[model samples]
Target: MRPAVFFDRDGVLNEDDGYAFEPSKIRWIKGAPEAVRAVNQSGYLAFVVTNQSGIARGFYGEHQVHALHEWMAAQLADVGARIDEFAYCPHHPEGTVTEYRQTCSCRKPQPGMINELSKRHSVDIHRSIMIGDKQSDLEAASAAGVTGHMFRGPDLKEFVAPLLKQLPRIR
Candidate 1:
C-alpha cells in the first residue's frame, strides 16, 4: 500500500468563492498545482475529499461539481499534475433538496470519505497526511487516523515542502 496526500478541494486547491461551481470562476490557489505535482513526484497518491453542500442547497447540481472537477483535472494535467481520485459529499442535513437532505458521514469533520478512499486505494493511514484550510479538514484527518496540516496563507507548495521531506521515501 502507498501513502496518500488528502486535500480539501475548495479553499485548498481553488479560491473559495462561496460555493463556486463554474469553470470560469475556478481560480487555482498559489502553487496548488505544483503542490499536487510535488506529492505525485514524491511517490504519494493524491486524492481530493470535498464537501459540496451547494448541491444539496439547490445552488447547483452534482453534474456541475463533476464538470468542475473534470475541468480542474484537465488544468492540472497541463501542468503535469494529476489527482488520483475525488471523493465529495453532496448531502447536508438542512439541504433544500429533498433527496439530498440527510445527515451523512461523508461530510467534512467526518472520516467517511477518507475511510472510503483508504479502502479503495489501499492507503497507509499513519503514513498519509491531509491538508486543508479549515479545522474540519483536520478533524476528519484525525478521525481517519492520519496526520493533518492546516494551511492558512502563503504558497501551498511552500507550506507542504517541509512536511513532504519528513515522509519516509518509498522503496
Candidate 2:
C-alpha cells in the first residue's frame, strides 16, 4: 500500500494569523514548496488537514476556505508540487454560526480526517507520517496510527529531508 504524508496547514505550511482566510494574507513558510516537492519525489501522497474554526466563528465561510486552498494549490503547482487532497473541520463548540456549532471528530486531536483519507486512498497508515506544529496535530497522527513530527521551522525542506529518508521505499 502507498504511504501518505499529512501536513497541518497553519504553522507548518504557512504563517497563520488566527482567522486567516484571505489569499492575500497568506505567507508561505521558507522552503514550503521544496518540502512539498520532496514528499512528491519520495513517492508519498501528500494531504492537508486543517481546522478552520474561522468558519464556525463567523469570520469566514467555506467558500473563502476553498478559495484559499485553491490559491495554495496554484502556488504549489507552480513549483511542481501538489496536494493530493485537503480536509478541514468547520466546527467549533462555541461557534457563532449555528450550522457549524457542534463538536466533530474531524477536528485535530481526533483521527477522523486522517482515517478518512487513509481509507479513501488505501494508505498504509503504519508507514505514514504527519508534520505539524501543535500537539493536537501529533495526537491525531498518533490516533491514526501514523508517526508525527513537530516542525518548529525556519526551513521546511531541511527539516523534511531526513524524515523523508525514513519512509520504506515504494515498490
Query: Clashing residue pairs, candidate 1?
Result: none
Residue-by-residue lDDT tens digits, candidate 2, 53-144:
99999999999999999999999999999999989999999999999999999999999999999999999999899999999999999999
Off by over 4 Å in 2: none
lDDT (Cα, tens digit) per residue for candidate 1, span 1-171: 999999998889998888989999888889999999999999999999999999999999999999999999999999999999988999999999999999989998999999999999999998999999999999999999999999986689998899899998976
For model 1, the superposed segments whose C-alpha errors exceed 4 Å read none
Instruction: Tell me model 1's lDDT, rounded to 2 decimals.
Output: 0.94
What is the Cα root-mean-square deviation between model 2 and the actual structure? 0.7
RMSD values for the candidates in order, in angstroms, are 0.6, 0.7
What are the lDDT scores of the predictions, listed in order?
Answer: 0.94, 0.93
